[model samples]
Target chain A: MDSTYINEIRRQFPILNQQVYGKPLVYLDNAATTQKPLCVIDRERDYYLHENCNIHRGVHYLSQMATEAYENARRTVAAFIHAAAPHDIVFTRGTTESLNLLASSLGQLLIEENDKVLISAMEHHSNLVPWQQMLRQKKGQLLVCPMDDNGVLDLQRYETLLDEKPRIVSIAHISNTLGTINPIKEMIGMAHKHGIPVIVDGAQSIAHHYIDVQSLDCDFFVFSGHKMYAPMGIGGLYGKSDWLEKMPPYQFGGEMVDQVSFEATTFNKLPFKFEAGTPNVGAALGLESAVRFIESLDRNQIEAYESALLQRAVEQLSEIEGLRFIGQAAKRSGLVSFVIDGIHPYDLGTIIDKMGVAVRTGHHCAEPVMTRFGIPGTVRASFALYNTMEEVDVFVKAVKKAAAMLR
Target chain B: MTIKEIQDAIVEDFSMFDDWMDRYAMLIEIGKECPLIDDKYRDDKHLINGCQSRVWLSAEMKDGKVYFAADSDAVITKGIIYLLIKVFSGQTPSDILDSDLGFLDKIGLKEHLSPTRSNGLLSMLKQMMLYAEAFKLQEDKK
Candidate 1:
């Protein structure tokens, strides 16, 4: 909310204070992965330097400290997303691994022959493929809820699909490619009407807006830390206590097992049961630092700034000749995707990179969305809290110039 | 002229442009002049598979010399293909096979091209070299 505070936040990210290709770096690829602040990086490094020990096992001082730090990171994640209890949070590799864990465990527990799992067409492949594999394994049906022309998921059709008695309704909280803020709360409510549990893929949404799992009442919420300025290879999945109690453990290993006999073994309780083996302890601390970083700023202020930036970018880019936006959803967050006439997205991406404005140009792991639009890919410029209007101007100019050259 | 001489000349031509924008313009101009592939050969069988853009390439071997004709949906990729064909066409299969084609890096084209386009360029080179290799094998049999 305070311009001075926002500027101070920008100064904390050291990577932003550099040049690429002889131009000041205008990084617009935050949707793929956000750059870490020095605090987060230093926190991880500090953990390795001082608190480097395996957690929840040894009675030694360092082990207890490490165990406390790791569990505290889980609590941090739980608090960030407004989960009711910290025990509901299970740490995994990232959004992809978290989703895989959910699909594997939940599929085994819930899915049966002829049972249907419904997902939106706008889903990132991570959300879609696991369900497809689950359906294939269980001999169940995988149903798609189609998105409208503006890339909004059709809620009417989704409601109708619920009549088919889908076992689960999994969808993205915000589409990574289109930046569409899906009406997930409403969708979850509708799915609950049919007693079908909903899994929210919050990988893209978690960085941009607040998430309250208790209010959404979704069965499971999954997201990656890297997408939100934390270290890679660490993420969290929050499952309701009832589901956590019922579903089986995703992996069997040292920490997750209560007692391992030659014949059988009983798993540990809520979180540790899901997080098997030696977890990425340092990265977990880094995620805790990232959570702290997000808390240090005003969430409403950050959201408003990013939303205004996206709006200004869309307006400025609309002035360029023959530029067509892919997603015109009424509610969008943090990004924009577009294709220009006669200029390949890849070509534009290359030139933009040369101009030192980094943007992602490809299917963005959402090939179904691209196929729906009948294009190879798109040039996506995703913003973070650190981005400025000056940088947006440079990006628009660079895109326009690139389009002209390609033409 | 020799293939190396032709490549060197093209690289020198690119050196005149200090700015990336001008270099890209030159490439686009070269793409405009690239020899069009035969419509019959524009089908999937003759199309280069790995390009981000749709690039159709066809080759003919007559009297042990390789001739390439290609077209691309994207101008920049078309220009890249033009450079390859300029160096490789009207040469013996052996001459085509032995050439290193470092001219791309010399002209700063490799760094300028996106990863996908660079892969496309490599695929185009592989396809041309493959044709040359095929022609060489046929000559051996004869």
Candidate 2:
């Protein structure tokens, strides 16, 4: 918990450096929301100070400049996911809002009574609940595709459900709780064969690895900016241009309107139709900065370094008596999750936090996945770019000490 | 109920549920306070099926106060409903709409909710607001 790299990154985040419970903070809650880099923090401050103006409608220079900067962020985001067109990237409040937008609009058009909506057990609630709410409204059946012992999607069971060919199948690109990187390319291909549109909840994966929309061919994809070193309340929904063109506007308000009459109002085209309000201009700029930051860093180097770190973690954690790693997927993105026998996750998390090593506790918005494992929750340590082997060692020692006290 | 009574209830009653052990006990007690939902309400029509724990919510209006009764198969979630009810219950429509429970972050435990559970809590709050909106409409018509 006292490692220099940890201390360095800790210093970078003014929020992270502050004492919690009379101890220096150890933040492992990156899976929930990441601490911003100084660059990201500065960019947000700089935006409000310099580039603060309402976009699209302003005739003045600042408004036009503001509009350009915002849309330029849109292009950077589109390029990040390898989307075909920039307009395919519709800015949203966050992954939750993005998913709900899809669920409410396309869900209304597609879902029906007893029509099955398929999702894997590993989905974050953000990915699952929108479909469930939509299915409930439509009197549709919600079906979960089972996972095997390793928490990988059970292809056999997936095929079984694929026979019903759910109207919509939503899956996470990576499991936030288990760190299971789902085999989404194959899953998407199989789903498309059955005419089921797949939405990849890329909230956890986007920061860790590369995502090419054309290669994966998922109909809808979502991720939050806050998870990827950007500010919160900004995310994007990537739907095929054609589908977005057809789907109804999620919220009725300014900017989405084409023409407003007393009788009926026409909506704007693909993205503006979905982006209903004033939008997060500052956060979007910060997200664009995040995209640039990730792009500028050597991604392959980061991946290799992260993989080695994860491998070392697995080896070390497995050595702890009664410690079991969930979903050792052999393919995870910059993360590892595990549980210690006879230690409640909450207790483990609190004790570790006291020693200044932060890790996520409880069901990680994927309680069904926790239920599948027959555990209340796990202590999840998710990694990011700034993390180092020394920090991991500190975390490991703290976990070992915590286990000795509790277990 | 006066705002001061509510302010006091929130300041005191919810603070005691901070420890998960105490939290669970408090939740179980809240379950005791909540009337048992009818079997008819357990169907897909009323069942909030997304929750990892089974949750049933039923609302009724007797006089002016809108009574909310919720039970969750998960013990902790039922307690979550209790915390929710403390803010939500016995409030006027406009007041309920305007109130920001952001102070929950300062107290902590709202983050204890898994993201899905957080959403379920949010949906429950939204549903409560919707209920208030509907009640206001009905009152206007009368």
Best by DockQ: 1
lDDT for A17 in candidate 1 is: 91
Task: List lDDT for all candidates, in order.
Answer: 0.89, 0.78
Candidate 1 clashing pairs?
Answer: none
Please give, for every candidate in the order listed, the TM-score of chain B alone compared with the true chain B.
0.90, 0.71
Question: How good is the docking of model 1, as DockQ?
Answer: 0.50
Segments in model 1 whose C-alpha atoms lie over 4 Å from true places? A1-3, B33-35, B46-54, B112-119
lDDT of 1 by residue, A306-352 (tens): 99889999999999989999999999999999999878887788778
What is the CAPRI rating of model 1's predicted complex?
Answer: medium
Q: How closely does chain A match the true chain A in each prediction, as TM-score?
A: 0.99, 0.95
Interface RMSD of each: 2.0, 6.7
Q: Which 10 consecutive positions of candidate 1 chain B have the poorest summed lDDT? A: B111-120
For model 2, residues B1-142, the per-residue Cα lDDT tens digits are 6434565566576576655335434544564466556677766666564333455677766566566666554444555666667666676665666666664554465564445443255666667778877776776687
Q: Distance (Å) between predicted and true CA of A107, model 1?
A: 1.1
